[model samples]
Target chain A: MSVLVVLEQRGGKWNRTSFEALAAGQKIGQALATPVTAAVLGSNIDSLATEAAAFDIQKVFAIDDAALEQYTPDGYAAALEQLIQASTPKVVVFPHTYQVRDYAPKLATRFRKSLVSDVVDLKTVSGGLSYVRQLFQGKLNADIPAEGDLQFVSIQAGAFRAAEPASATNPIEQFRVKLDPSAIRSKPEAPYREAQRSVDLGAAPVIVSVGRGIKEKENLPVVEALANALGAELAASRPICDNGWLPMERQVGSSGQTVSPKVYFAVGISGAIQHLVGMKGSKTVVAINKDENAPIFETADYGIVGDLFEVVPALVEEIQKTKA
Target chain B: MKIIVSVKQVPARDSSLRVDAQGKWLEEADLTYEMNEPDAYALEEALQLKEKLGGEVVVLCAGPQRAAQTIREALAKGADRAIHIEWEERAAPDALTTAQLLANAVKPESPDFILTGLQSDDLGYGQTGVVLAELLGFAHATIVMEVEPQGDAVRVKRELEDGWFQHVSLPLPVVLTIQSGIKKLRYATLMGIKKAKTKEVKTIPASQLGIDLNSGLVMERIYLPTRSKKTQIFSGEPKQAAHQLVEKLKFEARVI
Candidate 1:
C-alpha cells in the first residue's frame, strides 16, 4: 500500500496548498506503513521537486507535458488518473485548490470512486480510513470513510501542519511517466494572467489582516502602516473586498486564498466561517475585536478586546522602538 | 416566462449544534429550522422575475412532511404552486439523488428557466446545482449574483474574486445557482398567508425517482471543538512592540 500526493504548482514553484497536502500525505503514509510518493505534472517543476525531496517522499513522479504547461481540468485529471493507476496507490491526495476543485469530482466520477474533499481530519478506520469534513460552513462536522479502493481526498490548506522535512537523508529520484499529448482535447488558450496578482500574499510569513471592523475605506492607512512597520503583508476579510476596500487577492475566505502565515493579526474582523475557513490554519491567530463574544476569538491564540484604532498605533509604536 | 425554484428547509444559520450520543449527526433538537437562506433569495428572485416578465412562479421542495410548512410559507410569499417530496426512508440523500427527485417533479412544468440556491444550508458542498446541471445536461453557472432572461437564452452575472463580475448568456433549459442576498426576502402578506392555506402542496417519495448511485458518503461521527482560552496581548512602544509581536507571530504563531 502506498500514498500518492499530487502537488499543485505554477511556473515551477509550489502553491501555498502544496505544503499542507505533502505534510498530510506523509502523516497518512506513516500510519499506513507506506512511503508517500509525490506527483508533479508540468513542463518543469525544479523548485517543487527540490521541496518535495526534503519531505519523506520515496519517489517523485515528474511528468513533463507541454499540454500540462498550463492546467486544464481534462489534462490534469487524465494525467493524475494515469499516474494513479500506474502507481496503484491505496489513496490519492490533492490540495483543495481552485485548480483541483474544478476537476477532482470529474476524475472521481470517471473511476466510479468517491472523493472526500476539503478534509479537516483523518484517521485509520477498522479496515480502512475515515475522514472529517465541515458541513454547512463549519457549523457541523461530518466524519466519513472510504468504502472502496483507490480512495481520494483533498486536504484543506493549513488544516494540517507542514511537517518539518524528514529527519533521515532521503534520496529524491525523479520518475518519468509516459503521456499522449494528442489525447488532450482542450488546448489551453494563451495564459491570461490576472493583472492584479503581482503580489502573492501566500508567501508572506506575517500578514496583518483587517476586517469590516476597520470601519471606513480611508482608515486603511492604519493597517497598511502597521503591516509596513512589521514587514508584513496586508490582508482583509470578505466584507472589505465586497466593499472595495482591498483587492480580491487580499481577502481571506473559503473562496479566496487560504493562508497559513506565521503570524496573522486580525483587526476589526468578525470571524465569519467563510473567512475562518481561509485563515484558521494560520500558525498564530491574533484578533483585535471590541466585541468579546466575537467568534474570531474561538480560534484566536491571542486576542485583545479593544478598538483596532487604539490597539494598532500602540502596537506599531512598540515595533518602531524595538527597531531603534 | 414561467420559472420554477427549488428550495430546501435547513437549520437556521445561527443555530448552536452538537453531536448526540450516537455521533452520526448533530443534535437535531434545540435547533430552529427555516427556509434555506439562499433558497429564499432564489425564490425572491423568481417572484420578482415573474412580476416583471408576466409569468407564474413555482416553488419546489424535497423533504419530509414538516417541509410543508416551509412550502406553504413560500406560497404565502407568492409562489403559484408547491411540490414537496415526502421521503420517510431517507432523511437526507446526496445531491445527485435529490436532483433526480427534483427533476422528476419539475420537468412536467416545462418552465423556461430553473433556479436553486447554490447549495443546501445544511450541506454546503456547493455541488448540487452543478451536478444538477450535468444530470439535466443544462448549461449552468454557479455563484450567480444577477440574472436577466432573453427570449431564447438567459443572461447572468457571476461573482468572481477581487470584486470582479462576468456576464454570460446560456441557452434555455439552463440551471443557475442563485447566490444568497442579491435582494432581501419579501415577507408573506397577511392576505396571501390566509389564502396560502388553500393552495395545494404535493408530496412524493425518493423510491419513485428510480435512479441509484450507491450512497458512499455517510455521516459517521461529529463533535464540537473543545473550549480553550487562546488570547495574547502585546504592549510597549508602538514600532518595537509591533516588531516583538511580529516575531512571536511568525516564529511562534506563524499566522503571517
Candidate 2:
C-alpha cells in the first residue's frame, strides 16, 4: 500500500506547513514501509510542482484545474475525492492548516471515512498506527487508533521540522481531475493582511507579554512600564488584543505572530497551546502569574507565582535602579 | 429563513482536569460543566441572524443527558427550540461519527443554514462543521468571523492564520463554524430564564440515528502531557523575586 501527501499551495508559492506535512509523510512512509507520493493541487502550479519534485519521495502529482485557482471547500473536495478514488492510496496525509480544516473533513465525508485531525505524533502499534492528539486545550493527549482500511491524517503545524528534500531530476508528473463548475457554491475574495503590523515583535531582543491575568485595560501601563524599563517590546495574548487593549499586531499566538525573542517575559499568560506555539522558541522564557498551577509554568525557565500587578511594578523599579 | 446552531457542553475552563481510571477520558465526577466557548459564539451568531432576518433559530446538541442544561441556556438566549441527541455515557466518538449523528438528526429540518463552533473546548477536533456540511451536502466555511446575509447568498469574513482574513460569498443552505469572540454574548435574563422553561427541547436517542457509533476511530489512551521543562520556581517576597529576576536577566540571560 502506498501513502499520499496532499501539498497545499496558494497562488503559486507553497504554504509554510507543506514542508512540515511532507516531513511527517516521510516519517509515516518509513514506519509503514511504503512509498510516498506528494500531490500538489491548484491551477498553473508547475513551479510548485517543480519545487515539490525535489522532495525525497516517489513522484509529485500535480493536479491542476481552473476551478481550483482559488480555494473553495466544494471545489477542492470534489477534485481530491476523484483523485483519491482513482489512486486508492492506503493513507492520505495533510498539514492541519486553516485551509485543510476547511476542506479535509468534507473530502473525508464524501467517502464515509473518518479523518484524524491535528495530530501531534504517530506511533507504530503492533496492529497498525496510533496517532496522538491533544484535548482540553493541551491538558490531555489521547492515542487514537485508525479503524478502517483507508484512513486520513492531518499533522499539526510545528509538530515536525521540515527536512531537506533530496534533489529529484525527474520526479514531477502532471495529473488532472474533473471539477464541476456548478458544484462550487462559494466565491473567494483575495486574501488580505488584516493589519499593517506596525510592531514586528519577532525581531525584538526582548518581549514583555501580558494576558487575562493583567486584570483591566487600565492596568496595561503596569506591564508597559516593565517593558519600557527593560527596553523590550510590548505584546499580549489573544484576550488582550481581542479587547483592543493592544493592536492586533501586538498579539503573539497562532492566529497572530510567532515570536522568538531573546528573553520573553510572559506576565499572567496561562500558556494556552495556541499562545505557546508562538513563543516557545524564545531563548529564555520567564512567566509570572498568581496561579501556580498555570500551564505556563511547565514551559517557563523561571516562574514567579505572584500577582503581576505587584510583581511587574517591582520588576520595573528594580530594572530602573539597575540601569541607574 | 431557518437556522440550526450546534452547541456542546464541556468542562468549565477553571475545572482541574484529571485522567479517568480507564486512561481513555477525563474524570468528570466533580467537574463543573459549561457551554463550549466557541459554540456559544455560534449560537449568538444564529440568534443575531434570526433577529435580523425574521426567521426561526433552532439549537442542536449531541452529548450525555447533562447537555440539556446547555440546550436550556441556548433557549434562554432566544433559540426557538432545541434538539438534543443523547449519547451513551463516556462515548468517545470521533469527528466523523459525531458529524454523521448530527447529519442524521438534522435531516428533517432542512434548514437554510447550519452553524457550529470552530471546535469544542474539550476534544478540540475542529472538524465536525465541515464534515457535517459534506454529509448534508452544503456549502461550508470555517473560522467565520463575520456573516452578512444576502438574498440567496451570505458574505462571510473568515479569519486565517497570522492576522490574514478572507471574504467569501456562499449560497444559501450553507454551514459555518463560528470563531470565538465574534460578538458579545447576551446573558439570559430572569424573564428569559422563566420563558426558557417553556421552550421545546426534543431529545433523540443516538442509537436511533441509524449511524454506526462504533464505525469511527477508537481512543486507546489518554494521559496528561509530559512536562518538557523543569521550571525553577522563585520563592521570596514579590519585590525580592522581582529584584532577583532582573539580576538574572542582566547576568544569566544578559538580555537587558
Which residue runs of candidate 1 sit more than 4 Å off their true CA positions?
A: A1-4, A9-14, A33-90, A111-114, A125-128, A162-273, A277-295, A303-324, B1-3, B45-57, B103-113, B146-172, B181-200, B211-214, B227-256
Question: How accurate locally is residue B120 in candidate 2, as Cα lDDT from 0 to 100?
Answer: 92
Alpha-carbon error at B177 in model 2, in Å?
0.7
Model 1 lDDT per residue over A192-279, tens place: 3245675577788889999878889999998998899878989998667756768767878765677888778889886766688778
True contacts kept of 1: 0.31
Task: Give me the candidate number with maximum lDDT.
Answer: 2
Candidate 2 off by > 4 Å = A125-128, A290-299, A306-310, B235-240
lDDT of 1: 0.73
lDDT of 2 by residue, B1-256 (tens): 8999999899998788878888977788869999999999899999999989988999999999999999999999899999999987678688899998999999899999999999998888898999998888788999999999998899999998878899999998999999988887899888889999999999999999997776688888998777778887887898999888888878987877
Candidate 2 per-residue lDDT, tens place, A30-116, comes to 887899898999999888888888889888888888988998888888888888887788889999888999999888888888788
A68: Cα error in model 1, Å: 7.0
For all candidates, the clash counts are: 42, 0
